[model samples]
Target: MESFIILIKLLCAHLCSDFILQTNEINNGKRKSGSKGLLFQFIHSITHAGIAYLFVADWCCWLIPSVIFISHFIIDVIKCKCYKDSLSTFLADQFLHIAIIAILWFSLYGDEIKLSYFESFCSVKVWLTIMAYLLMLRPSSIFLNLFLNKWTPTSPNTQSLPNAGQWIGYIERILILTFVLVNSFEGVGFLLAAKSVFRFGELSKAKEIRTTEYVLIGTFASFTIAILTGIAITRLF
Candidate 1:
């Protein structure tokens, strides 16, 4: 119990320093080569160490702050130099930092935690949940694309953003599926209402009915599939 509390506090300090304190300018500055980048990186690391020390609130423990400052600075420097600015890089960077924090906590209070606590994740339900999410991404996407191809406009709107619809579908289906899995049908309704409100204006002003009809079919089909998938998963559970 105490170990978990310390872990969470450390994570809060990390979130505050990394996401709340660090700005776009600092993030961009750290990526630059030479002393200019090093300066920003140093400042960010100092902020992290300071916040962590304050959160830990142990005046006698200087080791935590010292290690945090050194490890964080080194990690950020390596990231800026080697990795490009992308989702995978960002996730990997965060994973490394959190892994360090976990290691530090484990060293101090390793005896308090038991290996048996993690055994629940090895169950069949976990794999099925992962499969459900994977299905939401590409499998459902290809299915919808092929089904909607018949209604695809001859003179496709050039003004639309590239792959915007596809990405939007992915996000909405995931959200809808999540809501249904949690048995929150109101969330599904709210999501539909919100989307309808946004589309109503553009749909009403459209000169032709094909664009409106296509959007309606796509939206409803996405919602229905997500809802049904969520229901099926819960039933299997």
Candidate 2:
């Protein structure tokens, strides 16, 4: 009963409320029009994270609530790609759609559950929790490209700032790096898919596989970091 309520609260509070509202703005093409409500923009950082959470929670067989925390971390990575540009609106849509999936999972799992709420509650240890999860979230390749752009060395041919074309090349490099880091050899399935999708953005078999790979990486990173940090804290304290 309580567990069901907790799931409900998570969907209503975090997934639906935040993710849906933000996604709508993008779909309606209001992001560039500059008329989106303040509330949507304020928490745009957390939109896509719900997808990663959904992926993990589904894998956990509906036994975990920690996915709520992880969702936000993943959202931040996706948000990194928007960076207050025209892409912001579409980014919101993608994130909210993922959240909706998570909500459906919550509903499908139903009322009763058996996990320890006490230990779950106790895992909220500020820096340890946030850092561990964010590490797992792995920022998006487009976002990584944006971050790298800030520090990319100037081209010898052009003394001025790097043009959009150069930045596009830089973005590709970052994507390649991201693919290498996330997929590895065991992730050959995802590597092929990611390579195709990044080369041509949008929904395709490759994009879906690549997205799944990213989710797995984030989930693994979050769980490993959280457990290791918990152990370290227990030993030290």
* Top-scoring candidate (lDDT): 1
Predict model 2's lDDT versus the native: 0.41
| Ten-residue region with minimum lDDT total, candidate 2 | 132-141
Report, for every candidate in turn, its global Cα lDDT versus the true structure. 0.81, 0.41
Summing lDDT over every window of 10 consecutive residues in candidate 1, give the lowest-scoring window: 117-126
Clash numbers, per candidate = 0, 3
Per-residue lDDT of model 2, residues 1-237, tens digit only: 344434433434443334334454443332333334333433453343444345334464533333443454355444544545334543564466456545655665554565655554533333233332232222232333343444443432253365643344334333333333333433434544664566453324433464445434433333343344434534432
User: After superposition on all CA atoms, what RMSD does each candidate show versus the true structure?
Assistant: 9.8, 15.0
- TM-score against native, each model: 0.57, 0.24
The candidate maximizing TM-score is 1
Residue range 146-203, candidate 1, lDDT tens digits? 6787898899878889988878898999999999888999999999999999989889
Extract clashing residue pairs from model 2. Answer: 26-89, 49-75, 136-218
